[model samples]
Target: MRQFFVFARKEFYHIFRDRRTLLILFGMPIVQVIIFGFAITNEIKNADIAVLDQSKDHYSARLIQKLTAGSYFRIDRNLQTPKTIEAAFREGRIKMAVVIPPRFGQDFFHLRKAQVQLLADAGDPNTATTLVNYARAIIGNYQQELNGPAALPLTINTTVRMQYNPALKSVFLFVPGVMTLILLLVSAMMTSITIAREKELGTMEILLVSPLPPHLIVMGKVVPYIVLSFINALVILAMGVWIFGMPVKGSVVLLLAECVLFVLTSLGLGILISTVTDKQQTAMMASMMGLLMPTVLLSGFIFPVESMPKPLQWLSNIMPAKWFIIILKDIMLKGSGLREVWPQTLLLTGMTIFFIVLSIRKFKIRLS
Candidate 1:
């Protein structure tokens, strides 16, 4: 512990001495968050949707079959009742829900009009909007086929409802994503670069020659960064909530705890990077190329993973940012608790342990 503090203090002094490093440490996340908050768009494909058919009539079944046949929506749930839509949305199961009222066949034939309700999860507003439009277009085509060459009195009205983010604010999506990207780059990139810099300066050998164990030496080096990254997380969270109107619908403590866990995971990844490279430039390159592109592309930060090819979708499972972003959205937007996010939480914990153990073995091999 005494040795840990000494090394930690040394790192603090080293960090403060480098002006440019300090700027990146604290300045970058804010700029990125603000920038990404306003930036948005994409096509929705194979989005999971739900169908609640109270009418259970021929018209309703035909409409559902028409909807299921299209490429835009996949029927994720054939709900028995309207009551389940909220739970489905909260569980992140279905993106949209179609409710067909009872007596659909009667209403269309006798009353000459029918109504269907569309409940879309607007967590990603563009997705919700696009899905609703797709469903409507399919419904329109069906209506045209039914009424072709003659003016029919029969009509179908769609009542649309947007859940979660009703106003479709892009900030809701970007804040969580930017938080994941920044935490990853800051913790992993900086840790790897700093360790590699020590190796480049030949100071790592002096530290290794000390009475302290190598693991503790490495731990001490990362502890300060863990603190700094955690602070960076909090700062970004504050900016997200206070500046961008982002809400912490779940427990704030749980959210912060997650941030710390992700920071440690990122730090472990950084340590792993440092073990493979001996130069700051090499470490920076690895962190940027290896971490940045994957986190941005594969993590569902920019593009929906479901929209990617099968190989890429399967490959994204290995990207830690992919899981972290899901956890963040669950906690921040869905108001989910440990019971809700436990699977992702467990995956992240496993990843943290994996990176640490693998880095340790590699470090031992290098030392020997």
Candidate 2:
């Protein structure tokens, strides 16, 4: 026990002495969370739009005012002819164009229907779709106000309740993904590199030949990293709750326990990586290329896994981050308990066991 503490303390000293490693371990998570939460977002704000109001009536003017009143859009230019609509989009000056047909008010009052054209730049289909939807919603609201509650012949009042995230803030979606990514990078990549560095310096052989058991040596090396990774997880959770208003709807103790499990999984994978590679650079590159890309692209972090093709969906099933992200969303957003997340927890545990066994076997082979 004394030997283990001495070895663990040495590992901690080594980590603190290295400034670059300390920065990457502590600084990277904060920076990534801020960037994903604020900079990369699905919510559109103050998008430029052009208006072509041909009717020049009270209804058309009011409609335009209603569209621009919200934070979704701002009128960048007013078009006189239909010819200029394409020019506005081509020049990158506008994301959408609103064209109110001739005699819009007359048609609305007498015929009980009016046609308004929304011309959107289809280059960015998602953003364009959102812009058009916003415009339609505003126009629908105005129509509702004009018609009154009993004006329509048939009415289907559909009430929509956005369960978990009412505002649909992108931060809520990204915080868990960011947490998963940072933990993987720090725990797996850093641990692998640290062990590989020892091998490169010929210090691993010295440690292996010492009085300590091989497993004890490995644990001593890894214990500091586990502590560091847990600290990082706490830091990210705090930032998400305080800075971005993300809520932990489940038991906070359960959340931290799950985080520790994930850290152990990553550490086992790191041990596996270190057993295979002899150089720090090789381990780092392998960790990034093998772990980072899959975690980002296949983990359903930025895209929906269900929306992917069947083969890709099957491929995504193997990504640990996919399960972790699901578990996090369920816990943080849905307020789920252990029973709800047992399947994912079991899979993560199995993966951790597999990695640990593989790494131990590989280490033994190397020793032989």
Per-residue lDDT of 1-368 in model 1, one digit per residue for the tens?
Answer: 88788879989998989899889999888888877765543446688988899998788889999998866789888899778889988999889999999998788778878888899988888788888898899988887776666763796767887777775676788788889999999899999986678788877778777887767777887888999999999999999898889988999999999999999999999999998898999999999999998899999987999999999999999898998999999988889999998888898999999998887776742342
Model 1 compared with the native: what TM-score? Answer: 0.70
Instruction: List where candidate 2 sits over 4 angstroms from the true fold.
Output: 364-368
lDDT of 2 by residue, 1-368 (tens): 89889999999999999999999999988898888778868899999999999999998999999998989999999999999898888899899999999999999989989999998998999999998998899999999887877555776778999999999898899889988988997789888887789889878777777777767777887899999999999999999999999999999998999999999999989988988898999999899889998899899999999899999999998888889999999999999999999999999999988987787777742442
- lDDT accuracy of residue 339 in candidate 1: 94
lDDT of each: 0.86, 0.89
**lDDT score for candidate 1 against the true structure:** 0.86
TM-score for each predicted model, relative to the true structure = 0.70, 0.96
